[model samples]
Target: MANGTTYKTCTCRDEKGKRLGANCPKLRRPSRGGDRWSSTHGKWAYQLELPPHADGTRRNPLRRTGFDTQEEAEAELDHARGLLALDEDAHVKRRITDLILAVLKNTKKLPDTEEVRRKARTHQDLNRQITVAEWLEEFLARKRRIEATTRNGYAAHVRIYLTPYLGDIRLDRLRVSDVAGMFDAIEEFNDVIAIERASGDPERIKKVRYRRPVGASSMHRIRATLRHALNIAIKQDRLRDFNPAAVVELPAVTRPKPVIWTDERVTRWRADYNARTDLARRARARVDVIGCYISTPRPSPVMVWTPAQTSTFLTRAERHRLHLLYRLITLRGLRRGEAVGLRWQDVNFAGNTIGVHWQITQLGWQPVQGKPKTDASDRVIAVDAETMRLLKKHRANQAKERLAAGDAWADSGFAFTDELGRPLHPQIATDQFYWIAFEAGLPPVRLHDLRHGAASLMLAAGVEMKIVQETLGHVSSTFTRDTYTSVYPEVAAAAAESTAALLATPSPSVLSHGRRKPSSARRFRH
Candidate 1:
C-alpha cells in the first residue's frame, strides 16, 4: 500500500519579511533543544509520493494544507492510500493518482474513494470528464444512419431545450429530478409564449418568434430524444450507469380522433372560417396587412371528407393535369410524398401493383428523394383495374408532353410530373388539392386526410383491421385502430341496429295470435 507523512506548516515571515513555509521557526520540535513550538502558530499538512505516468515521466508529490490537527491530515492521507490500493495494475494506480490530483486541484479536497473505485472497476476514462452538453453533441455526431429530418429534430431538442437546461451538469451526476426540472422550466416558458401570443401585439409576438407553446406531445418527443441518447451512452459507450430521462414524467399525448366532414360539422366550420376571414379583412384595412392576423382554432386537428364531398372534389379536379394523382391518393391511401415520388417503372399494369419504394421529403424548402419513411412503408400496393386504365391514359399524356418538350424534357421518370418531365414538388400537390376542394365548395380537409378517408372507407366496407394496417403500412393493428378507424355514420347506424335487434321482443299482435308466422315463406316440392 502507498504511504504518506504529516507535518506542521505556516505562512510566517523572517526578520527580512521573507515568507517562510516548512522553514518556519514555529514548526520546530521541543526535543530539538529549541523553544517549545507555539500551539496556535501553524496548521497540519500531508504529502505523498505518487507513481510515475504511464510513459514513465516523473510526477510531483500530492500535497495539501489547512488541517486543524495532525490527525485530520493523517486521516485524509489514509483515505488516499486506500484508493490507490483498490487497483493492482500500474496504469490503474497512475489513473487513480491522477483522479486524486484533479480533485485536490479543483475542489481543495480528496477524491471520493467509492467514486474512484467505480471508475477503475468499470474501465472508464479517468483523465477526461464529460458534461451532458459534450455527450449530447457526441451522440448526435454518431447518429449517422438516421434521416436528416430526424437528426434535425434531435438537434433542436438538444440545442433549444436540453442543452440550455441540463448542459452544464456532469453526465454521471444527472438525476431524474434534474430532467424533470428542465421540463418544468419548459412548461413555464410555454406560459410566456401563450401570454405573448394572446396579447395580439405584433411586436410582442415578433420578439418571441416561437409563438406557440410547446404541447404535451412535443414534450414527449423531447423526452424520447433525451432518453434515446442516454440509452446509447449506457449500453453502447458505458458512459453512464442510468438514464435520468427514462423516468422523468410528462403529460400524456392525446391524439384527436379523425372526424368526418358531415353536413352539420361542415356548416359550423364554414361559419367559423368565414367569420375569421371577415375579421382578417377588416383588420387588414385598419392596419398594415403584413402584420395583421386573425386566428381561430380548428374544430379538430385531423379531419376527413365524407364520400359525397370526396366525389365532389374529384369531379372538380377531373380536368386538371394531376387529376390521376388526386384520385389515386383518395382511393389508395398514398401519402403526399409517396404520390409525388412515384416512378413510372415502379407501376406494373400487368401485375396491378404499385411499388412504394421511394419518397421525396422536404428539408425546409428543398426537396430530396429518399427511401420511404419506414421499412413497412416500402411496400407494394395492389391497384384495381380502373386505376390501371387511368395509369395508361396518364402515360399517353406524358408521352405527348415529352415529345412537345423535345430536348428540353428532363425525363425524370416520375409517374406524376410537370409538362417538362421534372418531379412535382410536394407543396405544389398540397396547394392544388386545397384549391380544388375550395372550387368544389367542400369543407377543408388536408391532403393527408385523404389517406385517412381511404382507411375509413375500407373499414366501412367491412375489411379486416389487419388488412387495413398492412395496406396503410402501419407498424401494428392497434395503432391503426387507435388512429385511423374513424367511424362512418352509416357503419355506426348499421352496428347500432344489429346490436338492438339481438334483444328485440315479440310485438303485441304476434303474441295475440296462436302461433308465430314466418316473415318470408317459400313453396317446397314434395
Candidate 2:
C-alpha cells in the first residue's frame, strides 16, 4: 500500500479439504504468477487492520469479498487505506473505512473519493444522498433573524414551488438544465391558469383550481429565494462551482411607472366607464378600461391625479372619516401598510413630525405588525401645519367615537383604525379608495398612486431629489428620481424652460468691452 499499510487476500480451499484462509494458493504465492491474480479462479476476499482508537479498543478488521482475483480485492483495500490520509479523528477514520468496506462488501466497488470527502465535511449520512428538499429545510432552519412575514414568503416558495419540482434532485449535483426545465414547466402552468380562468365553467375551474403557473412577480421572488439558498450552499462549500439557480434566465420584471390622469382622460373615464350599471362593484374596471387607450395591460396606466384634481378630491373627501389617512399618504408618500401601521405614539404633534418605525402587513388575510419595509423606511417626516391640524381633529373625532362605543371600545392606539380601534385591513382601504375616487367624480387611482403623486408634487415644488428620496423612504436617490419623476412631465418641461431662460442671459465679455486682456484662445464653430 502507499502508506506502508498491509492487507491480506485469500480464497478458501486446500488440498486437505480445509476451508481456512491459510490454505489459499493465491495468498501463498501472490507474486509468483505472471499476473498478480492469474493463479486463482475462485472468489477472492480481502482484509485490513486499522489503527486502534484512542480508547485502546480494537475494531474488527475491515473485510470484503466476491472478486474474481486477489489483485482486484487488494486494489479495493488500498482505496480504503488511502482514505486514512484525511487525518480525522481515530474513531472517525475507522468508521469511514468500515463504511467503505461495508459498501464494498455489498457492491464490490469503492465509493467515489469526492463523495466520501463531502460526507466527512458535512458529517451527513454516508448511506443516503442529500436532496434539494432536505437542503431547503436546512437552509430555512438556519435562517433566523428574518421577519415573520419574510420567513413566511420564503416558506411558501419552498413548499409550493421548489419541493414539488426540484426536491428529488441531489443538492450538490443540481444542474442548470434541471432549473430551466422547472421554469418551463411553470410557464406551462401559467397557460393552465389562463385556460382555467377563461373556461368560465365553475366545475372545470374547480378540477385544477390549485395548480397554476406563477406570475412575473412570483417567478422573481422564487428565483430570489433559490438564488439566496444556493448562495449559502456555495458559501458552505456544499456546492463547489456553479449555482445553477444563478445562471438560469427568468422573465424581466420592470417596476410599473406612474402615469398622470389628465383632465381629458378623466373626462373620458367619467363619461365612458362610470356610465354603467355595474359601476359600483367594478370600479377597478374604470381604470382598467381607461388605461387601455394608453397601455395594453388590463390595468395599463398607474394613474396619478393632477394637483387641481387632488385638491378637488380632498375637498370632496373632507367629511369622510378616512380623509386624514388619505391626506397623510398624499402628502407623505406612506405605503398602505405604513399608513395602517401608524400609531398615535409614533405621531409627534409637538414636533410636527411623524416617526415611521413600524408597519402592518398581511400574510394572507391576517394582519402582522412588523418592522418597516426597509431600513430607510423607519424615518421621521415633517408634516404640514394643515395636515397636523387635520390629524388633531381626526383624533378628537376618534375619541368621541370611542366614548360612544363605551366599554366596547378597543384601544389599539393606531392613527387610523375602525371605530373599535382595530387595525384596518389593506383591502378595506383599497375598496374605500376606489369608492371615494368614483364618488368624487374623479378618475380612478390606486391608493398607492397617491404615493406617486406625493413624490412628483415634491419634485414639482423644487424639493431636492435627495430630500424626496428620504421622504419616500427610498433606499437610493437615483431610484426615487427615476421611478417617481416619470409622472412629472409638465414640471420637467417648466423646469427646462426656466433653465433655458437662466442660461439665455447675456454676460458682457472682454471682447465686448473697450479694454480686453490678451488671449490666444478662439472659439471654434461646429
Candidate 3:
C-alpha cells in the first residue's frame, strides 16, 4: 500500500495564464515567524494510485481535494489505503474483481466498499435489469405455504393482465406512472369489452372472446398483487429504494347493500318477471336467439324475501326434488357451499342439531372441499320443531329414493345430492332456486340471500343477538347486529312503536280545552 502524496498549492497564473508549481517566488523562504503561510500554499489535497488486482489489471487512481492542512489530507489517504488493503484477502479480492468486471461490462461506475459487499452477499445481478415477468415468475415459484387457490389467483392475474403490459419493463426501473398507466389501460380495455359485448356482429364480439371486463373489484385485486410483489422484491433486497406499486391509486370498494323482498315488491316483480320471461321464451323461440347478448340475464346482486313470501316459496318448493335443501338455507341460514358439502356424519337428528364442518369451494368452476370460511363457521346449530319435522320427512324421502335406486346410488354420503344419487353441483342449487322462484311467480331472491333473510327472521322473532350470531356462526355479535339490525323492517318498526307508546300523552280528553293538562306534577289520585 502507498502512503499517497499530500501537496499544498495556491492559484497562481503565468503571463500565459497557466499555474506555476513550487516555482512561485513566495515559497522561496518561510515567513518571519517560521510559519509556512506562503502565497504559494492555500490548502492541502491527496492523490493516490490504488494497487493493481491480483489478475494484474490496472486500477483507477483515487483523488480528494479541499483539505485545510496536510494532516487532514493524510488521514483520508490512510482510509483509502486501508480499504484497498482488504483486497489482499483472497475472498475480498475475488469480490473486488467481480465488481470491476461488472463496472467494465455494464459501463457502471465503481460503487463504494459497503455497496460492493452488499452486491457480493446478496448475489443479485450487478445491474437490476431483470424484467417484471421474470421476477413475478420467481415470486410465484418461491410461494410454498399459501393455499392453492390463492396462488392460482396470483398466477391468473400475472398471466392474464400483468404479463402483457408490465412484463417487458425492468423491475428495478418500474415507475408509479407505469403502474397507473397499466390500470388506465385496463379500464380502457374494459370499455372495449362492454362495446364488443353490445355489438350485434358475431365477428366483432369474438374479438373479446373469453375476456371479462376489469371491474372495480378486479382492479383492486390487480393493485394488491403488484403492491405485494413489489414489496416482496424490496424485502428480499432484490430491488432497492423505490416502491412504485405502493403509490398507485386504487378505486374505493363499495359493498352492495342487502335488500328485502317485501310482499308489495314481490307481487309487482312477480307479475313483471312472469311477463318478461314469457316474452323472452316466445322471442327466443321465433329467432332461436337463446345465447345471444339480448337474452343475457342482468347481473343480480344478493336479494331476500319477506317472511310470508319465504313461507309461500317453501310451500311451493316442498314437492320439488330438493325441498329440504331450500328449507335448510331459508330457515337455518346455511351458506350455499355448506349446504352442498353437508354429510350424513355431520347431521344429528336425535340431538336436533346440524353440524356444519366441511364446505365445498370453487377454484374456477372446479369444486374443492375445504374447511369452513372461519373456525367459527364450523358450528352445531339446534333446529326448530317444524324444521326437525321437515328433516324427518326429507330423510324418509331420501331413504325411499335410495331403495328405489338400488345399486345405482353414488354413495357419496352427501346429505343432499342429484336425482341419480350423485353429488350435486353446488351452483345447481342456485340455478334451480332461480327457476323455482320465477316459475312460482315469486320475487327474484337469490339463494344466498335466503341466508340473510333467515338471519333477519330470527332477529324479528325476538331471538337474542348473541344467540342469532351463534346460530349463524358469525365470528362476532357486533357483525351480526350491524349487518342485519335494519334488514327486518318489522323489528325496527316494533322498536319504534314501543318507544312511542312509552311517551304518549295520557288521554287527551282529560286535558280540559285551555288547561296545561292539570299539571303533570300533581300527584295522581287512584
Candidate 4:
C-alpha cells in the first residue's frame, strides 16, 4: 500500500437519511506518513518501514483505544491527532517542561543551582562532613600535648574502646540511639566470658567474648573526651548536636575508703629500713676504700671481696633504697610522684619545708609551677624534726655520691636519684614501696594511702579539720572532714557517750513526784 495519512468520520443516519448532530464525528491526521486510520476496522493503526536485513524484516503495529460513543471517541482521537502533528524535537521539549513542573509542584521547595553551590562551599569551609575517625584523630592530637600520664590514659581508651567501635561512623550522623546500642553491646561483651563458661557452647562464643564496659570513673573520662571532641565539631559547624555520652547513665562507683598503716606498723617498718640503711652505709664505706686501691697504678694492697660479699653489699643498698621510699611515704605523706620528683632546691633545711613544685609522670618528672590540685596543696608543709634529720642525712649522703660521680653524674638536681644522679621514675619507686611493705611484713597500700594515713593520724590525735585541710592541700576543710571523720573512733565514742548521758538524766517531773507531802509539812513547821 502507498504511504498515506488518514481522516475518519463517525456517521449514523437520522430518520431523514441525513446524519444526526451527535451521530457524526470528525478526526484528522498529518499528511507525513507515520500511522493511518482504518474505516473498516474502526481504529487507528501504524505501519513501520523497516530497513532490509540479511535474515528477516521486522514489522511493528500500533494500537489505539476505541469508544462506543462516536462523538466522544472522535473528540479524544482529534486531541491525539493534534499531538502527533507536532515535530518530535518540540514534543520532547514540551514533555520535559511538563515533567519539571509536576516535580516542582510535588516537592514545593528545591534550591537553584547557585544556592546549592553556595551551600557546598560553606560546608567545605567548615569541614562539617568530618567522619568519626577524623574527629578521633583531632581529639588525640589535642590530648598529646597534655601531661604524659593523661595522654597515655586517653590513648589507651581510644585504642581499646572508641576507635574499634565507632571509627567508621560520620560524626554528624551519630545519634543517641546508636550510642545506646553500642553501650548495650559493650555490656554484653563484658558479660560474655561468664555466659560462655556457663553455656560451653561454641555457637554462643560471641556472647562469651570478654569486653570490659568502662567503670563510672572511666566513663566520666570517656564522656569528657567525647564532649570535648563534639564541642569542637559544633564550633566548626561540623556537628549540630551535643555528645550522646553526656546523657547516658553512668554506672555508680563508690570510692574505696583509704586504708592507713597503724603507728605500730609504721614504727616496725621504719626500724627495719633504718637498720638496712646502716648496713648499706658500712658496706659502701668498705667498697670506697677498696675501689681507691684497685684504681691505683702501683700494687699497694690486695683485698678480695667474694661474690657473696659483693651480693650482700648490693642487697643492703637495695634494702636501704626501699627504706628511703617507705620513710618518704609514712613520715612525710608525700605522693609517689611528688617524692620521686623532689629536688635539692625543693627542700629547705633552714625553713624545714618541702616545695611540691613538680610531679614525676610516665614521661619523666615535669615542672608544674603554675598550680597544684588546690590552693592547699601549694602550701608549705612544716617538716617534723625526725623527718628533717633523716632528710639532712640523706642529703649529705647524696652530696658524697655527687662528688664521687663528678662529671659522669646526670646532675638532674633531684634530691632522690639513682647512683648516676638521674631522677627516679615514680613507677619504680611505687613498685619498690610495695616490695618494702612486703619485706617489712606490713599490709599493702598505695602511696596515696600515705597521705590518707597522715590525715587519719591527725584526726585520731585531735588535730583540727582546718589544719589537716591545709596540711594536705585540700581545697576546703569539708574535704578533710569527709576523709578523716569516718576513721576518728574518738569522735564516734564521744557522740555515743553524750547520747547515753541525755537518756540517763531523770526528767523534772520524776524527781518532784515523790517530794510533794514533805514540802507542805516543812512550810507549816517554819
Candidate 5:
C-alpha cells in the first residue's frame, strides 16, 4: 500500500471488480500483477517503480519532496519522467560513473615512479626556478661578450641600481606596479641627497632634505635600465606578460647644449697661459738663490725652495696631456676611444695618415681592437704638416721614456702611453685633460666637446659640407650639416651676401637695352 495519504480517488475497477473511489483506500496501492497504475481518467498509466533484485530484495524507490498539492507533485513527477526518458544514455551520466571510479581508485596513495620523475624533470625544464639576481648575473655575463663599456654599464645597473631595491624579488612574480614603486623610491632618495647638499650647514646635513627631489634625466635613465632588464626577463620566459615599463611614463629630460669657449675667449686664455709660463720659469731661478740657506736641512731646503717649480712642472705636464687630447679631438676630429686606442702601427708616417681600427676602454686600461664606431669611422685621416711634426716629437719623447724604463715598461703597442709605455686609461686621460683646462684658467669642457669644436671650426672656416662630413667620418653629409650647421654663422652670412649680390646685379636683357638706347635714339633722329 502507498505510505502517504492518497489525495485523489481512482474510479476504475480492479481484478476484484470493486469501484476504486475515495472510500476504497486498498485501491491506492500499486496493482500487484501489472506494470501500470489506474489514473482518474480510467486509463493505464506508466509509473516510476524500483526494480527487484535476483535475490528477491526490492530496491527502494526515490522519495519525492512534499508539494502543496497532489497536482504540483504529479506535474514534477511528469517532468522528471520525461527527462529520464530523453537522457537515459547521456554522456554526462557515463562521465559521472567514470569519475566515481577514478576517485575510488585514487583513494590509495600512489607510488613515486620513473614516469613521475620524468614528468617533474620536464616541468622543471619548461618552468625553471630563476631569481631576479640569477637572471641578472646571466644577462651581465652575456653582455660582457659584446662591449666592455656596455658590460660595465650593465654591471652598474645591477649593482648600484637594481640589486639594492629589487634583487630579492622573484623574476617570475615581478609586477609592473612593483617596478614603478621602485622608481619612485629611487627618485625620493635622489631628492633627499640633493636637499642635504643644498643645505649650507654640513653638520646638520641629515636634517635638510628636498621636498621634490631628483632630476628628470636621472629618473629617465633609471626607467630605461628597468625597461631593458624587464625586456630581457620577458625574453627568458621569467615574465609572462608585457613589460610594465611600456606602460609607465618616464620623466622628460631636456639636455642642454655643452658650454664651450668662444674663439676670442680661448685666445685670451692661451695668452694668459703663455704669460704664466714665463713667470714660472723666472720664479724657478729665484728659488735657486734661496737654496743657499745652510741652516735649513738639505731635504727641507730643496722642498721649500722648489715647491713652486714642482707645482709648475706638474701643471705643465697636465697641460701637455690636454693639448695632445685637444689636437686629437678638435684638429683631427677623432673619437675619445679612437684617439686613446691609437698605436704607432696604425699611423702611416710616410703616408701622413692615421688608421682608426681600435678602441681604448677602462677596466685595466684594456684595448679592444675592432672596427671604428661605424663603417664610415674606419677611414684613414690625412695628417697636416704641423700635426705630423707634433706627432714626430711626441713619438721621440715616448721612445725615450720606453728606453729609460727598459724591461719594466709594458709594451702595450699604443701610441699614447704612460712613462712605463703601458696604455693609458681613457678615463685618466679625460680627467687629466679637464684638470689641465681648469689650471690653465679655461672653462671646464667635456672631452667630446673637442669633436664639436672641430666640426664648428670647420663649418666656420667655409669647408665644404661633404668634405667636413668625410673628414669627421660621419655616415652622411646630412648628419654633419645637422650637427655643426648651427655653429656656422659665417657660412650663413656668406650665403646671405651671395644672395644679395645676385639680387643687386641688373638683368642681362635690361643692361643690353640701356646700353643701346642712346644709339637707337640718335639713329632715329638721323
Candidate 6:
C-alpha cells in the first residue's frame, strides 16, 4: 500500500539448471482476463522498499514469497504498510522497519505490529534485544550498593537456577508458563535428589551435588530475584511490559517454628541419639554424628534451650574464655555475628547497655566485617545486673591475660577474642557453643538458638512482646510474634488461661468460696 508490488515467481530452471526467476517464459504467458501473466505458473510474492538506515545507506527491499495467491501477498503488504504508517517520524519509522526486518530474518515472520506500536507509543527503544541471562547479569552488575551477602545470594540464584533454565529466552518473549516450568523442573529435580540421597549407594549420593533439595523458601527467593530483575527491565528501560515471574505460582513456605528443648524432648533426643550411636558401633560403622551421618534427626530445625538447660550451659562454660560472650547472647538475644563483632567500646558499664552497631558475617567461611544486618539490627540491648557483673569480671580476666601475654597480645579491642586477642570468627564461636553443649551432656541446639532461648525466657517472664521485639531488634512486632511466639510451656499455658478467663463463668465451688458463711446465731434463727 505505501510503495510495494505483488507478482508471481517460481523456481523454474533453464537447461543449465540456472533459476529463470522473472525471466521465465511461463510468467509472461497470457492467462485470464487479458492479464499478461499466467495464473497457475508460479506462487505470488510481495516486495516493499523500506526506509534507508539512519546512516543514509540504501536498504534492501523487504520480500516474501510462497503465498498461494496474489490477494494473500497484497494483504500482507497492506499490513506492513499500516505498521509503517503508524508513526510518521523518520527515526520511529526506521525502528519499525528494522524490527520487521530482524524478525523476518530470524523467525521468517513479521514482527507483531500491535506490540511494536505499543512500544513505540511508550517510547521504548525497540532496537535493544537482550535475553533473560543478559538482563539478570546487568541487573546484578547495577546493584552496586547492595550488601555483599545479598549480592552473593543473587549471584547464586542466577548461576544455579535462573540462567540455566531461562537464559536463552528473549526477555520480551518470556511467559508465565516459562517461569512456571522452571519451578516445576526444580521440584522434579528435588525428587531426584531425594531418591539419590536415600539410595545407600555412595556413588549415587555423590552425584547429588546439593544434598538438600531446593526448598519452597529457596524457590520463593529465586522467583523474587527473577521478578526484581524483570521489574527493573520494565520500569527502568521499558524493555518489557510484564513480569512473568510475578504471576507464577509456587508452593507456600512455612517458617519453621522454634521448639523448646524441655525435659521430655531432651530425654527423647538423648535416647534416640544413644540408640543411633549404639547401632553404628555394633555395625562397625565409623559414625560421624556431628556431620549428620548415622545420627538422630532433630525434633525441630529450630530448637531453644529451656532456662534450666541455659543455666547448665552457663555453669559449664563459666571456666571457658568466651563465657561472657555466651552469656551475653543467651541472656540478651544477640545474634552470633553481633556478639562476635562486639568491641569493648560498645559496652557501657555505667548504663548497663551494649550497642549493636557492627557485625562480622561469614561469607563462605571468610569473616566480613560490616554494619548490622539491618537498620533495626543497630540497637542497644539492656543487660541485667548479674550479667553486667559477669561482664566486668570477664574484662578483668582479659586484662590479666593481656598483661601475661605482653608483647604477644594482638591488642584487639573486641569483647570476645582469640588467644592472640584477634576478633573471634563467627564459625569459631559456633563451634565452641556446639562442643560445650555436647560436653555438658545437653541436647544439641544451634548457636543461634541461644537468641531464641533468650526470647522464650523474656516472654515466659511476662515481658511485653513489643519490648521483646525491640530488644531483639526485629523490624516489626508481627514478625517477632510469628517467629518467637512459639513460647515455652509456661508462657503458652498462661496465654491459654488468660484467653479462657475472658469467657469463664464461675463454678459453684468458686461462687461458694466467695460467699460469706452464716454466723451460728443466724443459722439457729433460720
The number of the candidate with the highest lDDT is: 6
Candidate 6 TM-score versus the reference: 0.49
The TM-score, computed over Cα atoms with residue i paired to residue i, of candidate 3 is 0.47
Best by TM-score: 6
C-alpha root-mean-square deviation, each candidate: 25.2, 27.0, 28.9, 35.2, 35.7, 25.2
Question: Quick one: ranking by TM-score, best first?
Answer: 6, 1, 2, 3, 5, 4
Which runs in model 6 stand beyond 4 Å of their true positions? 1-253, 283-289, 292-295, 504-526
Candidate 5 lDDT over residue span 202-305, tens digit each: 55465443234447676666667667877876665456435655544333464333223455544654565455446546654322111111111111100110
Instruction: State the local distance difference test value for candidate 2.
Output: 0.71
Off by over 4 Å in 2: 1-253, 271-299, 505-526
lDDT (Cα, tens digit) per residue for candidate 6, span 1-526: 3399998889999999999876788887765667486777888888898898999997888889999988899999988888898899999999899888878788887776766876788787776667889989989999899999999999999988899878988887776555755665566356446656655678878877655688989999999999899898888644545466775645558657888887878788778878867875776444444433112456776688889989999999987889889998898898877898898899999999999988776532357687664456789999999988988888888898888888999987988888778788776776677668877877877677788899889999999998999998877799788887666888889888777764454433455656634552243334
How high is each candidate's TM-score? 0.48, 0.48, 0.47, 0.39, 0.42, 0.49
Q: On lDDT, who's better, 1 or 6?
A: 6
lDDT of 2 by residue, 283-303 (tens): 432233322221222133367
The TM-score of candidate 5 is 0.42
Error of 6 at 384 (Å): 0.8
In terms of lDDT, model 5 sits at: 0.54
Error of 2 at 453 (Å): 0.5
Off by over 4 Å in 4: 1-252, 259-319, 363-373, 488-491, 494-526
Per-residue alpha-carbon lDDT of candidate 1 for residues 1-526, written as tens digits (9 for 90 to 100): 2378887889999889988987897787576675665578898888888888888987887888999988899899899889879899998998888888887788888776666666788797876667889989989999899999999999999998888778888887776545755665565456445545555678877967854678888989999999999998787544445466765545557756788877888888678767756775664443211111111234565678888888888889987999999988898888777889999989998999999987775532356687654446778998889889989999999999999999999989899998899999876786677667776877766677798898888888877888888788765689788776545876677667666664464543554455544441111110
lDDT (Cα, tens digit) per residue for candidate 3, span 1-526: 2557876665667899888653555544566777464534566767777556667776765556667877888887776555555446655655554554466456633444544545556665544457899999998998889999999999998887777768988886675545654664565356446656665568868867888987878888887887889889988766664466664544446545566766666566546545655765765443212111112222234456888888889988876888788998888898777888888888888898889997664433346676554446789988887877877777777888889899897788788887657777765776567667655656555566788899999989988999889888777798788778787788799789766765564554456674646544242221
Please give the lDDT score at residue 240 for candidate 3.
Answer: 61
Better of 3 and 4 by TM-score: 3
The regions of model 3 sitting more than 4 angstroms off are 1-216, 219-253, 267-283, 286-300, 501-526
What tens-digit string does per-residue lDDT give for candidate 4 at 1-526? 1232223344556678985432243343335785444344333322222222233443332122345444554454443333323324443323422332344366532223232233243434221246777888877886656899878777776676666666668876765434433443344243333434445456655643554445557766765666677777766556653455554433346544443344554465446545544654665442222112112221111111122322233344355744554455554556555677677787888988888766564311122222233334456777877778878888788888889999988978888888879877554565454444444444334445556666765666667778777776665687677655665455557658667766665544565665445545454344
